[model samples]
Structure formats: C-alpha cells, structure tokens
Target: MDLATIWVTFTSWAGAYSWQVIVTLAIVGLYFLIDRLTIPVLSRSADNARLTESSGDRAVGLARLLTGTLCALAMMVVWGVQFGSVLVFAGTALTLLGVALFASWSILSNITAYFVILLHPTFRRGTFIRVLDADNYAEGYIADLGLFNLKLITENREAIVYPNNLLLGRPCVINPRDRLRGVGKLPPLPPLDVVPNNE
Candidate 1:
C-alpha cells in the first residue's frame, strides 16, 4: 500500500474510535450522578412523612410507607419503557401510588404539628397525662407537650391523644423544659379523686 493511503486509513479508524469513547464516558457520568444525587433527594419525602408520634404505631407505619414508596419509584424508573414504545399503564399507576403515599404522610404530619403548637402553654414537658373520656393515657415521654394537645408516648408503646379542651378542664403537672424529651423517667401525676361510675 502507498504511504499516504495507509496513513489516511489509520486516521479514519482513530476518529471513529474516539467518538465511541466520548459517548461511553457520557453515559457513565450520567449514571453515577443520578445514583449519588437523585435517589437520595427522592427518598427524603418519605422521612418528612413520619413527623409525628415519638414511639407509636403511626410513626412506624409512616416509615414503612416511605420505604415502600422509594423502592417502588426506583423500580419504575429502572424498568421504564424504551423510546418509540408506548408508556405502560403500570408506570402511571405506580406514580399515583407514590403521590398518594406522600400526600397522606404530609396531612398526618401537619395535623401532628398543629396539635403540638396549639396546646403548648398548658402542656409542659415530661408530664404524665391521662385523657378524660378516652381510653389512651400517655405517660412515658413528654415528647412534645403543646397548647392544643399533649403529645405523650407511653412506655407500653401507645400514644395518648389528649385534646386541648380536655386538658384545659383537667389539672396536670410537668417535669422537664426542653425541646427533646427522652422516653422513660416520666414524672408522676397528682392523685385525682375520681367518683365511682354509676353506669
């Protein structure tokens, strides 16, 4: 072969190989960026959903819902339909499911925050609470003793939902004065004189 012809053939092959390498590198860079950033950001909504209940079923249930949602979203994205093909109805369904889960969590979290802030003054921290006209009596941690209601999680794993109206009428006491109240070592309540129920 002539010297010029050989040189031309080698240059053409090198140009093609360089283009392929550039495309490959771009794909790899995108994959790593999504894995490191996108997944974590998407998973955070789940954590925000579990805003209430320091140690009760509601909190645990929220956690489970959050985990399930993140897993489902990841699966859908990974298994999404390819270009030029119709998107599956299943993908839409999964997206709706994720939205619903997030909505419910947000509503519940807001309710908990509202209850805590409204009932703050009368409801001090570390106070053992008994709800009148209710089956729940929270007594472990004054997780958040608020104005509208007293948020207490008992040692037995039950959250006592005491309303502001009820707490306002009944007298109570507290033991601590901090933002975070740990479980156990709850202060005792003064003995109340309850008349026998003549039902």
Candidate 2:
C-alpha cells in the first residue's frame, strides 16, 4: 500500500485501541508491583505467625493466585468483555475444574484447612505435637504446613507427611519443647498451651 494508506491504517488502529492498550499496561504494571510487595508482606506475616518457611511460600502462591485473578478481570473489563459472558465462562470453567478434581476431594479440603492451621497459634513451626487416632497415634515436631499436607519430623528424624484435613480431624496435643534445646546456643522454650483431647 502507499504511505498514506499505511498511515491511515496505523492511526485508526492506534486511535481505536489506545485506551485498551493503556489500561492493559496499567493493570499489568500494578499487578507486578502489588505482587512484589504482597509476597514479602505475606512471608513476614507468616513468619511472625510462627509458620514454617514453606508455609510462607505457600502464602505467596495463594497471593499470586488472587492477584492474578484480579488482574485478569481488570484486563477483561478493559477489553470490554460482556458481564454475562464472563459469568458463563467462569461457570463452565469451574464446572469442568470441579469435575476433573472431584475424585480428589481431600486436596480441596486440605487447602481449606491451611487457613485453619494458620490461625491456630498453638500449631506452628518447631512446636512438638502429637496426633491421636483410634487406630494409631503419631507425635512429632511440626515442620511445615503445605498446601495439601502438614509435615512432621519425628523423634528419630523421620518425616511424616500428614494430610492437613486428617490432622485437623484427629485429636492433637501440643507439647512445647525446643528441637535444639540440648545444643549450647538455643534459648529456653516458652510456655505453649496444651490442647488436650476431652474425649
């Protein structure tokens, strides 16, 4: 095409989509900035809550998911996606996802349990805990609270990857003791509340 024709097409395209471009850029930039700030704050919050380092990481992951979803919705708005279409798409996607993961109900339950564990002050990293079950009992140092599981390190240094839902389901005892108490440098342990099973 001639220069005038090319110029006309370019200006028309830019004029038509300039606002979309600006909004998309703004949304993306804000998402990154929020992500950078949010992860560190969440990690610090987790640490202050005496959660495991990996739990902090899981918090970061959850933050990213929420922030990313918001960013996607903002971009969709900028692109003028219809509200009804958004609803239909979201419903269909969730239905498919639920159908796909329906057999793994424990996974969903464990994820929901993560918050329960987080809010429980007595259940945290480095705490000595015992889980009692009718069939068998387990006691260990609470190590990490993951997305789908709680990791416990036993007296013999064996790792027990307990499901989060199951851990919450069973009766738990919190016995406070420093994992490195015998070592010279570690400080004395604080008074941790013992939540006994009233069964």
Clash count, candidate 2: 0
Off by over 4 Å in 2: 1-37, 49-54, 81-84, 94-104, 134-136, 176-199
Candidate 1 lDDT tens digits, 112-186:
444333334443354444433232223445455332355667757667655544444444434433322323343
C-alpha lDDT values of all predictions: 0.46, 0.76
Error of 2 at 140 (Å): 1.4
* TM-score (all chains, Cα) for each model: 0.25, 0.60
The candidate scoring highest on TM-score is 2
Off by over 4 Å in 1: 1-27, 37-86, 89-94, 105-199
lDDT of 2 at 186: 29
Query: What value of lDDT does candidate 1 attain over all alpha carbons?
Result: 0.46
In lDDT terms, which candidate is top?
2
Clashing residue pairs in candidate 1, if any?
A: 118-147, 118-148, 119-146, 119-147, 119-148, 120-146, 120-147
Given candidate 2, what's the lDDT at residue 10?
92
